[model samples]
Target: MAEGQEKPKRLYQVWKGSNRFFCRGRLIFGPDVSSLITTIILIGGPAVSFCIKVNHTINVNKKDGKDSNYWYIVLFVAALLTCLDILFLLMTASRDPGIIPRNTKPPESEEGFDMNTPSMEWINDRTPHLRLPKTKEVIVNGHPVNVKYCDTCMLYRPPRASHCSICNNCVQKFDHHCPWVGQCIGLRNYRFFYMFISTSTILCLYVFGFSWVHIAQNKEGILKAMRKDILSDVLIVYCFITVWFVGGLTIFHFYLICTNQTTYENFRYRYDKKENPYHKGIGRNLVEVFLSKIPPSMNNFRAVVCEDDMVAEAPSADHVRTSKEKIDIEMGDKFSESNGISLPEILQNLHYDDLEGNSKDKERSVDFDIHPSPFVFELGKRDELVIAHETENIHQV
Candidate 1:
């Protein structure tokens, strides 16, 4: 749009990750056999409802063959899922998802130094952006606005803020983008998202567990469910077989979350072709991610790391580090305690990064930089934009 200015290369990501789902990039929480997840949800939602209608309940009076056959179908699906979970675990231990590590180029401490090898720390080890200029705050819509323009998403952002491409807004408490639920988890919808996952896991386990009862109630039906369709009908046999695929994904994700690891970190446990300077970004970054600390960004990437973790075993997952143990964090002088939620004070409670925000932390951090080009959330807008264009077209036509 300007002289001598070339258009930026198109960056595409349908999900939370930076890479396309089908690329050699690894799958973190999805189905073991790849895009099997979409099918599982599609089928599970309907199949479960159908089974409930016919059987009257998940725990039906199954002294009869039909009841038992239904149970076997459940078990058949569950067992298959167990195997997928095993595969997911193995993949986590041996695969690479290509995580973008924190930047060590500026070293937070040294601005002008050019070094070949950046420091080896995790993404959770650095502040996301340079501190805003020390000045009085301006209140916007009754709330104080802290940061200037975000170079990453290319807009002025507020504290406790982030840009969600799926929603195409700077959401507070930015969580991962989810495709199945058709929403980005932000501060407002995060509770529902967590509830959805927690409940969904229970549903999977519930269905999988009942399969055992089905096998016990009717031995013949159980065998039939397990039997590979010798009829050579791929469609019919797959009904039960796909159970293994979906079940595995659900269980695998359960363990990973309980132990406090993202699909990204789980894969990072294996090999990464890119240099992971910020190897321990998880150590305590969840608080920041969940709490939503927006800054004047450069790229869409945020470089900040949290002081401590919220989960019980948070230290192991969020605090996990590869090398370089020493860390100093800085806190800014101005911090808001709206509704008694004080970030600067809370950040002070952590062991990593100094509590003095401003020019202080910028002097010490080694591995982290905010990435530019936040998500291009253009969903739901198509209808609105289309309507406006159509109005103009009608007038012209």
Candidate 2:
């Protein structure tokens, strides 16, 4: 509250996920972002070696009265691809991956439950538990799908949404947690993730193909040429090995994009066995994945929020029951003193059969006169009190 004191910390500072923020929460990265260092070294190191080898080849060719313009073009293209791949990697890792906001408490609405059909069971002396089903059926694409409730997030996950255990947050259209980029591949960043892998594959092949060409320019045999430039030999081997990994990933993701399937769903659900609910035609699927507008992030990581308001602890069942008991006791005492009849006597004398019969008969005759009281109306509003009293009697037995 002091005028000279610093402002409260932003939401990113107090964020629950295992994510790091930079530029005052303008940029976000997963906890494993250090893995990107290895990725950069693998891609950058090979590209740099390729450029050096090409430059040396160009110099040798120029001295032999040959045109070295072709080598210059190769070098330029290699450098451009390397830069583009790095940009894609950064875009994939540094941006939000469509994280869904967490709920402070379980939803209290009756939309998902059939309250009219009660499956109540009396177990010994304890109150009947009003259990809610874990999975709710939702209609998606004209087919019924079961959406599970997440206890940690306190919500039913939307279609294609899943919780990433590493990030400790629910992500929309979650693909998988990619350790290479140190981020979750989800709706917001999957496009850049695909681009990063595809570009890396191209860059690796470029270096691999050019390094061999640099060696072949020698007048000697292939073995002799490789021996002369050891760096080019190393780059050829490195690129050859790396291409398999990145190239395979690129091809796999291309299939995923065409079929409108996430890596998570493809492996777990195995849509190959059954009809894919999400699949449209190939053209429409590609447009949905790549050309669709990405949804905005749900969290404002840099926004200022009150410290007290930030901690929304859900009340326990026992705590709620205790509070309700206190209210019932207080209301009962007040009602008993105002009206001559005690609360228990009024409840005992109330006959549901008589009330039902009176409703059926238009000109009904009553044996006893009924007086409408504000306390009776107040008691009618507290239905939980009757349940609590019945539970107490059961316990006494």
For model 1, residues 183-228, the per-residue Cα lDDT tens digits are 4433344433443444445444454444444344444665674463
Considering every candidate listed, which one attains the maximal TM-score?
2
Q: Which TM-score value belongs to model 1?
A: 0.31
Candidate 2 clashes between residue pairs 3 or more apart in a chain or in different chains:
none
Candidate 2 off by > 4 Å: 1-6, 108-131, 311-397
Candidate 2, residues 29-110, lDDT tens digits: the string is 9889999888888778888878887888789889988999998999899989999999999999999997766654333322
- TM-scores for all candidates: the values are 0.31, 0.73
lDDT of model 2 at position 292? 72
* Alpha-carbon RMSD of each model: 18.1, 17.0
